[model samples]
Target: MRARLGGLPTFVLLVGAAYCLFPVAWVVVAATKSTGELFSTTTLSVGTSLLANLGELGSYRDGVFWRWMANSALYAGLGALLSAALSGVTGYALAKYSFRGRALIFNGLLAGVLVPAVVLAIPQYLLLSKVGLTDTYLSVLVPGVISPYGIYLARVYAAASVPEDVVEAARTDGASELRILTSVALPMMVPGLVTVFLFQFVSIWNNFMLPYIMLGDDGKFPVTLGLYTMLKQGNTTPALYTLVVTGALVSVLPLIALFLTLQRYWRIDLLSGAVKA
Candidate 1:
């Protein structure tokens, strides 16, 4: 019985792993091929044009790829930080405090999470344009900071991780509510907050529609939009395929590194949350 049960999970695990890694494998192999070999050769057969492809991509528009990467880092890093802070505060408040309209606020934030990014893109662009904020860094960063899902995660983390007795003791010792939140609760919530930050970081990093709509200038484009524009043009100029593939390879690196490094924190905190529940 044990062996059969174990084999069942192993088979499922292999299938799931293959489903996830198949695209990554395809991208890595396809990226090594030249334009002529792309459709001509087998999808997995690597061509000898990787270096030349990289060189051509580098020379394209005087190295626009790096600029887009930097812009993406700015948006994701700063935006995630702000999102984490807001989520921690708002989540803690909802979990710890009793007040009127709390359910209303929580429900509203939950609803906001279900709203698609494409739905807000045009309206956000128009609104920012009206205030002369369109085409600027603030236009992208500001909207990104207001993540509803982050708040929801933050509330869950705060409630699960933070002990009510600890909070009561801190209050009895005359710590201000803000101080209890900042020092006592914040430290306990670190793992969950990191999870929230990572999620928001990826979301904003992968986001294309909003930035594409908001910015007319190429300089301000995030990696996703920048790669997409290259892709769109690549349909006409198949040479841009090299840049698109190489850019995709580069863009995926940081996220992988981050997930590997921080995965332990997630596991540990997750176990803690589960025990509390």
Candidate 2:
């Protein structure tokens, strides 16, 4: 009975992995197919038109597909970087400082996390519209910079990884608070911050609603929105199905690469934290 119980968790994990990866697997196979094969061939079967499909996708609207790709990179990459920085600073301050209304502020941010993103997104659009910022890149980029969840993670990480004595020592040596945070605390919190950055990046990358609500121009559309547009249009123009599939496949590669590259930092940070503990 105990053995069976232990195996159950593994079974659940495998099931969950398959549930998530099944679509990805489908896209890989589907992207290779020609429009005819997309409908006619086996769902999982490989097709020969991968290169041809890519070429077609590139030619669409004078390589707007690549433009979408660049837009996604900019939104996710730059947004995540700024969000991580703000999270790190905010988190470190919350963890290290003692001041008035600190708990209240933290609690408010926690509540912000609980509020549904859709709820906030609507208000964000309305507010940005008031300032003549709607339909602009800043509309998307600015809101993503302040992640309550990222700040929360950074606080937890700073609390765990940054020692009070080290902070005091930096202060004793005449380092400014900003200097201490940047030079001492930030490096220690890299692992957790990287995780935060990855989360924000993926969230922003996969985010359809915010950009969908914010941007009016197709040229400024991220891959998620761009693919959504393609998928929507595919209902009328069937050939676009292949382009959409290929774009979906191509779009995930950068995220996969970023995750793989930064994953090592997570391991190293864990080991270092363990040793410190």
Candidate 3:
């Protein structure tokens, strides 16, 4: 029974992997097909048009797809960076400091986490519109900079990772709070902050509704919104379907590259922490 139970988890994990990877596998296979072959061929079969599809995607609408990619990179990269910095500072403060209304503030953040972003989109749009910032890059970027979930993660991680004794010692040595945060606590919180950055990056990259509501210019649309437009257009011009598939495949590469690169840091940080502990 023990052996059977041990194998059960592995079976479940395999099933989960398949559930997640099957669609990705399908996209990979489908991207290789030409428009003519897309429906006629088997779902997983390879075709000859992968290069042609890529060339067409590049030339489509004066290469608007690449512009979408660049926009996504800007939004995700800058937004995640700002969010990580803010979350790290706020989280460290919440974890380390005692002050009036701290509990209330943290609880509010918790409440914010429970609230769906979809619910806030319209209000956010109205606020931006009041500032004449609607349909601009700032509109999409400003809201992503403050992630409640990221802040909560940072708070928890800071509490666990940063030792009070160490903080006290730094204070005793006459380091300012800012100095200590930058020089001490942040180093310890690198892994957690990396996690926060990655999460916020992926969230911003894949976000649809916020961009949909805020952006009027196709030129400023992120890859997600751009692909959505392409998918919509594909309904009328079916050949664009191949381009959409190819774009989807291409759009995913950056995220995959990011994960592969950052995962190394996560492992190193985690392993170093384990060794120290």
Models ranked on lDDT: 3, 2, 1
Native-vs-model 3 lDDT?
Answer: 0.90
lDDT of 2 by residue, 129-236 (tens): 998999888888888899998888788788888999999999999999889988999999988898889989998998899999888999999999999999999999
Instruction: Write candidate 1's Cα lDDT for 1-277 as tens digits.
Output: 8768988899999999999999888888877888888779998888888788777767779988888999999999999999999999998898878799998998998899788888988888888788899999999999999888788778778889899999999999999998998999999999889888988998888888889899999989999998899999988998788779977987898988888888765542333342343
Off by over 4 Å in 1: 265-277
Clashing pairs in 3: none
**Poorly placed runs, candidate 3 (over 4 Å):** 1-9, 264-277
Candidate 2, residue 157: the lDDT equals 84
- Can you list the residue pairs that collide in candidate 2? none
lDDT of each: 0.86, 0.89, 0.90
User: Candidate 2 at 168: error in angstroms?
Assistant: 1.6
